[model samples]
Target: MNRSLVRHWIALLLLPLLAACGTTPSSQHYLLTAPEAPLPQGMTPSIGVGPITVPEYLNRDSLVKRIDSNSLAISSTERWAEPLEDGILRVVALNLAGLLQTENVRLYPWHPKRAPDYGVKLRLVEMDSNAERVVLVAEWFVYRVADDSTVARRLSKQSRPLPATTQNGNEVAAAYSELLYALSQEVAASIAEAQGNPAAVSAPST
Candidate 1:
C-alpha cells in the first residue's frame, strides 16, 4: 500500500474509538411500592371511585423528578415518584375493594348495572420528596349518588423522613406505602362517619 493511503486508513480506524470514549450509564429505575394493610371495615352503602385527578404539573415530562421536590437535585431522566403514585392508587383501590367487599366497593369505570350509592373522588394536591422527608397532601369527597350531594369532604397531609443509613428503592417504596395507607384510612374513616357508624369512624394509624 502507498504510505499516504496507510496513514489515512489508520486515522479512519481511530476515529470510531475516539467517538466511543465518553459514555455514562443511566442510574435510575421506575419503581413503586404496594399498600401495607387491608381496607377499613363497614364501608357499606356501596361506593364508587371516579377517575383520580392529578395536579397539572405532575403530568409534564420528568414526572418522577418533578414530584420528588425533596431531592436536592435530580437528573432529568429520573422516574421514581410518578410510578409510585400509580402504585399507591392501585393498592388503595385493591385494599379498599377487598375490605369493603367487591360487591359494595367500586373502582373506576362505573357500571350502570352495578350502580353504587355513593361516589368517591380524590384530588392529589401535593406529593413531593426531599432528602429529609416526603410530603403528601390530598382532598377526598364522598357524594351521595341518589341526590348527587357531597356527603363528606376531608383533607389529609403526611410527612415522613428517610431512616438513618438508608437511601434506596426499598426505603422509598416503604415510605410511599405508609403514605398511601394513611390516605386510605382517612377516606375510610370519613365514609364510616357518613354512614353513621360511629365504631367505624376511627381508623388505626398503623
Candidate 2:
C-alpha cells in the first residue's frame, strides 16, 4: 500500500484507543440507608420479612427515573450498589428492628423449623422517581406462621418531593429509604396490634 493509505489504516486502528483514553464517566453506585435513632422499649415478637418483589422494570442494575407517565430514563452511569429488592429487605428489616424494638428480625426463606411468629410478604407495585418527586406503592400482608392465617393486609402509598434540579442518586435512594421506613412502621404496628397491644396502634403514624 502507498504511504498515505498505510497512514490512514494506522489512524483507524488508533482512533478507538484514543477514544478509549478520553475521560469517560465512571458508574456511581448508591445504597438505601435505615434510621439510627434509639429504639423504643418494648418486647417485640419474632418477625420475618420478605419475599419482597419489585416490578420487572425495576429489576435492573441502573437507576430508573420516570420522565413522564409513559417514559423512563435508565442511567448508564448511575447504578444501585445491590439488588433493589435485597436492599429494600435489608433496610426494612433494620427499620423494623428499630421500630418494633426486636432483634429477631429475619429475611425470607428461613429454616422451616425456626419460623418466626409472624411473616411479612411484600409486593412493590410501583417505585418511581423523577426530578419532581419520589413515589412508592406497596402491598403487604401479615400472616401467622403456624396456622397460615391472615393477620393483616394493607396497601401503602407514599411520596416525597425531590428537588427539581437534583440529579444525584444518593438523594433518590434516601427518599426511597424514608418511604420504606414508613412502611416498616406500619408493619410494626400491625404486628403489635395483632398481639393485642393497642398502645402501638397509633404510635407508628408518620
Candidate 3:
C-alpha cells in the first residue's frame, strides 16, 4: 500500500476514538422547589398529602422544555419521569408544611400509626406552559379521616405571566415559585376553614 493511503486509513480509524474520548455523559438533575406561604392562625393540624395526580399531557418525558412557533424541544440533558413526579410531591409537601401552623406535615408513603385528622388530596388537571403564561388547574379535597368524609373540596386555578426575554434557571424558578405559592395558600386556607376558622373562608380570594 502507498504510504499516503496508509496514513489516511490510520487517521480515519483514530477519528471515532478521538470523538468518543471528548463525549462525556451529563450528570445533571432537574429539580424545582416550592415557595412558602403565610401560616394560618391557631392551628396545628397534622396533614397528610396524598399522591399528586398529574394529567396525561403533563406526564411527558421532558419536565422542562421550550415550545416555539416552529417546534417543541426538551431543555434538560436527561428526561426522568419518576424523579419529576417525586420532586413535585416533595415541593408541595414542603410548601404546605411551611405555610400551616401544624405540629407536623408528612408526605405519604408513610403508614400513619393512626389516621391523620385531615388529609389533603390533589389532582393536577392542567399544567400548560406557554410563552405568555403558565396556567395550572388543580382540584383539592380536605377529608376528615375519622369519619372518612370530605370536609371541603375546591378547584383552584392559577395563571402567571412568564418573563418575555428570560429563558434560564432564575426565570423558570420564579415562575414555579409564584404558582406553588398560590397553590399552597389555597390549600392552607381550606384546611383552616375545615378547622372552623371563619377568617380563612376568604383567605384564598387573592
Candidate 4:
C-alpha cells in the first residue's frame, strides 16, 4: 500500500478508540445533608457554629472510602455538592438547633452584640467510610465569650452501618451525613452538662 494510504488507514482505526476514551461517565453529585429535627417544646437556639476543619484528604470534591486497612478508594463519578467541611458545619449547626429546641443557631462572624450565648468549634479527625460503615471522629468545644473561656469540650467518635439494601457511593455519602447528626447529639449533651455545671467540661490531659 502507498505510505499516504497506510497513514489514512491508521488514522481511521484510531478514531473510534479515541471517541470511546473520551466518553466519560456523568458525575453524580451527593450532599452530606440532614433534615432539621423539630424544635423542642420551649427551648430556643443560643449557639454559634464556627471554625470546623477536616483532613486534607477529605477536603476534596470527591468522596473517599477506606477499602482496606491501609488503602482508600476515591470515587470519580460520585462527587460532593459542596466542600465536605462546609457540609459538616451546616449539618452540625442545624442538628444542634433542633436538639436544643431553639432557633438561636448562627454561623461565625455574627456581630458581637447579636452573637449566641455559646460558640461551637469543631475539628474533624476521621470522617470516612467503607462499604460496611461510616465513621466520624471529632474534637468539639463550646466557648463562652462573656467569660472568655471554654465551657465545654469533648472528643466524640461515632459509626453508622451502611444498610445492606443501600447501594454504593450514594448510600455511603448518606451514611456519613447521618454520622454527623449522631455526633451532634453527643456535642449537645456535653453542652447541656457544662451549662448545668461548667466544671463538668472535660479538661486537657496532663
Q: Which candidate ranks first by TM-score, i.e. highest?
A: 2
TM accuracy, model 3: 0.74
Candidate 3 deviation (Cα RMSD):
4.7
Candidate structures ordered by lDDT, highest first:
2, 4, 3, 1
Cα-based TM-score, every candidate = 0.70, 0.89, 0.74, 0.82
Candidate 3 wrong stretches, greater than 4 Å:
2-10, 13-28, 36-43, 64-72, 76-82, 198-206
lDDT tens digits, residue span 99-205, model 1: 34443767767877777887777888976665566677888887887778887788889878877775554565567667866777676666667778745433333
Q: Score residue 104 of candidate 1 by CA lDDT.
A: 70
Clashes of each: 2, 0, 0, 4
The superposed Cα distance between candidate 2 and the true structure at residue 181, in angstroms, equals: 0.5
Q: How close is candidate 4 to the true structure, as a TM-score?
A: 0.82
In the range 62-102, model 2's lDDT, one tens digit per residue, is 99999999999999999999999999999988787777777
TM-score of 1: 0.70
Model 1 spans > 4 angstroms off: 1-23, 26-31, 36-45, 60-86, 98-103, 201-206
Model 2, stretches more than 4 Å misplaced? 2-9, 39-43, 200-206
131 Cα displacement, candidate 1 (Å): 0.6
Candidate RMSDs in order: 4.8, 3.0, 4.7, 6.3
* Candidate No. with top lDDT: 2
For candidate 1, give the lDDT of residue 155.
85
Q: What is the lDDT of candidate 3?
A: 0.68
Model 3, 74-131: lDDT tens per residue?
5554444345557667777777766665647767655757566778788887665666
